[model samples]
Target: MINQKSEVKVFPTNLMKQKETTTKLAIILPGAGYTSQGPLLHFSSGHYFKQEHDVLQVNYRFSEAELNPFDTDGFSANVLHTLEETLKETAYDQCFIVAKSIGTIALANLLKHPTFHNASAIWLTPLLHRDDVYQAMLQYENNSFCIIGDKDFCYREERFANLKSNPSLKTLLIPNGDHSLENKEDVLGSIDMLKNVIDGVIQFSN
Candidate 1:
């Protein structure tokens, strides 16, 4: 789907190019203000594409005035609307999700749909403060991973520590990194952070 402000980028695997949903798929969800074009977002999508999995990236917009990560209802509606429209024509037999920040909220809500019940996921900078996120995560039936920074104020490390016992859930904690997992003051350090993040993505998606 395409419009003035929103776009959905789909990279079909070689197999899917000839057919559809005949291969594994990776659905990417973006942060509130972060479009699917963001470095990390598309970077991960590329990884999935390289792995021979189809990719669907959602780029959407919501009114900034009414958007609040905590409230989530408006944000959720915006994301679902874009997703439903972008994916209404197809169904995937195997799908996984990669989401960041508010994207985690969107992914959590998406999990409610039967289509994604057992889909594995990768959560980046999830809003642990929101029950809908961590709570919905509990219902995830497949292996998953969550990557967050120590300096990310949106969530607490203590909340994530509680998930240590979940065998299906893997966690990566970045030092001095913020919500985007970047250390604004140390660009060099952020490279290492990015490496770790991408490594986790590769490991999880495979």
Candidate 2:
């Protein structure tokens, strides 16, 4: 079943049988300007849906003034509020998060929530520049996967190395890939990069 609304879209695998078996929910959080329909998130959510997981894609919109400091606590708060309210009544045995860019800030906040403490995450091009995002990644105790491009402005070698120290965390660095994990000089290479990231997601699912 599918439901499309202003703030979010829901794709349910088995609404009637959700309570009979363990329920798996996948939440896709997009970047500031990137919508859930973007390549990475669109495909990721489709994959989760194919696997019989209920998928929720958040379509958050913010004004220019509100986004001036996209990584601020206020911005994170608004995202968190929307998420918590939208999901307050949903029932699931497991939760999975796929977050990119500013969504990573939301992921940081979600990690602290009691309901999602054990949730696994796929962080794509996270804003490691933000102290909160970095600290959350540093202290996360559950299974999580992260992918970032070496060329992205948010990418920090020292910080990436530190995150790798966490045995439970899996990190993938795309050479010459930008914030979108695309190679500006080679479209074919960018496609390959996407394939590699999807492969990581598949492995993480297992």
Candidate 3:
């Protein structure tokens, strides 16, 4: 985990990098109470696409265990702003975002922001509620994929159906898995689904 800190429009931004040789880049956002290192480990162990792509895991404003207090709204805004600045600096040919749980909602919020537009996204167990922000994300034009575990407490079949009702979104269900993917054996299935999504993204980019 490569830790670095910078200021983006007055907001302190912390980031971690997992470098690879490929042109593709993945901007990862962790779930609530999680750090970039957590996602970095998961991606490094499971995401074969990383072998051909660089993974940039970002630590949101209030998600850090130490040095910051939990403030959902403020952290969300910081995530959007940080992503906007990072995109400008990196100027990647094809940028893809992968967000888990709360991170997914944050990424969706970023999508709705005018300053952060036009990026493909993958949401893993997105913590979506009945809100205008969720509606706005459903209407966004970018290619999107939402992956949910069938056994996830926060996401049920009804919720999955509701999200899939959006013609623009694609959904993947991992059976008997939870929000954290605690069922270690089920990870292969999750990885397979992720691989398929990455393959689709590659085809779309080409």
Best by lDDT: 2
RMSD of 1: 5.2
**Residues forming the 10-long window of minimal summed lDDT in candidate 1:** 9-18
Listed in order, each prediction's TM-score against the native is 0.83, 0.86, 0.67
Ranking by TM-score: 2, 1, 3
Give all candidates' CA lDDT scores.
Answer: 0.75, 0.81, 0.60
Clashes of 2: 0
lDDT of 2 by residue, 102-133 (tens): 88988998888888889998889999988989
Candidate 2 has its poorest 10 consecutive residues by lDDT at 1-10
Candidate 2 residue-wise lDDT at 197: 88
**Can you write out model 1's per-residue Cα lDDT over 1-206, one digit (the tens) per residue?**
22234333332212222243445778888786777777777788888777767787776554565363345555555666766666677666778788988789878888777777778888888989888898766556678898999999976867888867677888888989899889999999998898889988888766
> Compared with the true structure, what per-residue lDDT tens digits does model 3 show for residues 145-194?
77666667766566667776777677777666667644466667666655
Residue 120 C-alpha lDDT in model 3:
75
Which ten residues in a row are the worst by lDDT in model 3?
1-10
Give the poorly placed runs of model 1, Cα more than 4 Å off: 1-21, 68-71
Which prediction has more favorable TM-score, 1 or 2?
Answer: 2
Q: Cα deviation of 89 in candidate 2 (Å)?
A: 2.9
